[model samples]
Target: MNQENNIVTRLGLCQRIEQLPQVDIGHYPTPLEPCPRLSEALGGPRIYIKREDCSGVAFGGNKIRQLTFTIGEAIHQNADTIVHGATTQSNHCRQAAAVAAQLGLKCYLRLSRDHKSLVQGNLLLDHLAGADVELVDAPFGPELDLVKYALADKLRSDGLRPYVIAAPQSTALAAVAFSWCIAEIHKQQQEMGIEADLIYAGSAGGTQAGLILGSKALGMKLQPVGVAPIYWEDKIDRIRQAANNAAKLLNLDFQIADDEISNTDAYIGQAYGVLTPECIQALKIVAQMEGIFLDPVYTSKAFAGLIDHIRKGKISSDQTVIFLHTGGTPALFAYNQELTDVPI
Candidate 1:
């Protein structure tokens, strides 16, 4: 498809999703700032950072886009309560609690022992926002997922309506918000006269899914790169599934293939939530060079991959690239002890 047709079809996709129930919450068209110093430091492609961090919710994130549709649907269904089961200090759950408070809906969070104590970072924010947080001894598995559902059931037994914002695999509602985001990105890049050969971001699969599907629709040869902050059993498979799920949701007649999905599990070091030396070093580079803060977990890991790719000649010097800054800055405080050795 040509640029005009691409824009038209992209708008059509956006309109179709607009017809679905949604609530307005985020600050749109988040600044796409050039990373000159960081780019010079890497001596690679010119880099631009998509500031999803300024999304303007409980500190903004890529999840705000997802929750706008997710909670919007809950509102459409007249749900009085919201439940989220996740690892301790979940950026998602923290924002969920903030959204519930803003919308006057009850919020419940089930956090595991992954982060040790619940009195810090996003957990503290969740508590202040009046979320009914339960710190359970649940391991990261199906049992924890069930624990969230059980909470919803209990609410139902008490004659209350509850909606569970499960993982992205549970539904394509979150994908809808991000599909709109890709359309926005395309417009921004067009106006800026830039072509992003590779777009890098921390991959949970869902957000990457929407970006790739949206990029495909807009006829941009943009490669959406997924950096595994933590290991998944089958990372690319999950991302491809998310892309297909998005296509199904948008009713777009396109198959998302594996070749279009670019990702790597090489950066996941210790595991989920455990930051590696490369990640910490990357965080310092961005902070020191560009005066921009990056969380120790997701964005740092993805950016570490970006830097490594540049260092390894994976990205050519003349190519244009972008790092999708999915926010998690609050989590930095949670890792104070581990980050103490890194210079401020």
Candidate 2:
């Protein structure tokens, strides 16, 4: 590790990651807390939580880390406006809006869902942040890209240079943000003398990708396990590709193998954003026992999978696990109607 640059050039990643123009948008080294109550509830296999939910940006979330780099790129390019697209209650959109507001850049978000649902949670934050939000007729997919480009073109025509931060294919910059975290986590584990066996989360690929690449580059024994809440099929391959892509961006030789990228889709019951019984139970368990509020969509489902693994003895009684709380607590209100019927 190069102490001066904070880049572990031995792996060839942190150097390039440091070279990128990034701003500090999130509270780093989020608190790592031991979850004794939840651990005993599962009967064994001690569990710890990475509290990214307190990242300290407009309700806090993992997206703030990603935006720190991507938004930095916008400033590096001297862009006056930024554009993004997502579902109605996207944590990413909310964080992007907050970052843009903080940085004094004009921001716009094209959302797929309308605000028929209560104007609360992330949606309300997006509005409060003063982002120019537009409701799109199409769903969030390849089609949304067309609308975003059109909006950017319109902005260009109106004499403003716009930066589009939604790059599904190019995740190197976003991936680098989490890559540094892998090093932070390794240090935390070492300093605390905790030998965690598994580190899991609800992955959209970027976070899992960077961790997978970082684990290999840094030779960490524990790789990331992603609970896919989307892309029910081919999710692992997608994550593998994302890891490789990130490595390419960093000029690193690190490659995440098939088995190295661990994930499961059993908890993605129903569909995206549709709360399941296990999700509700996991949310209730963490909130009631630990006073930690997990969003209904991502962390809850991932934690449910972790719980399922423990209950089925897949995680064994002797092991320790870490659950990455990638924060979407603001989305809880968006699903208040559904959760009201979940029986706590």
Best by lDDT: 1
For model 1 the local lDDT of residue 80 reads 95
Residue pairs in candidate 1 whose N, alpha carbon or C atoms collide under 3 angstroms: none
lDDT of 1 at 189: 83
Give all TM-scores, in the order shown: 0.95, 0.93
What alpha-carbon RMSD in Å does predicted model 2 have with respect to the real structure? 3.1
User: lDDT score, residue 139, model 2?
Assistant: 80
For residues 1-344, write the lDDT of model 2, one tens digit per residue. Answer: 22342225333555667777878788888888899998888897888998888888888888887887888888888998989988899899899999999989999999897443457898899899999988888788778988999999999999999999766543665567678777777778877988687888898678888877776677666658889887546676777777787777777755668887778878988888888999999999999889999999899999998888888888888898888899999998888887889785
- The lDDT per prediction is 0.84, 0.82
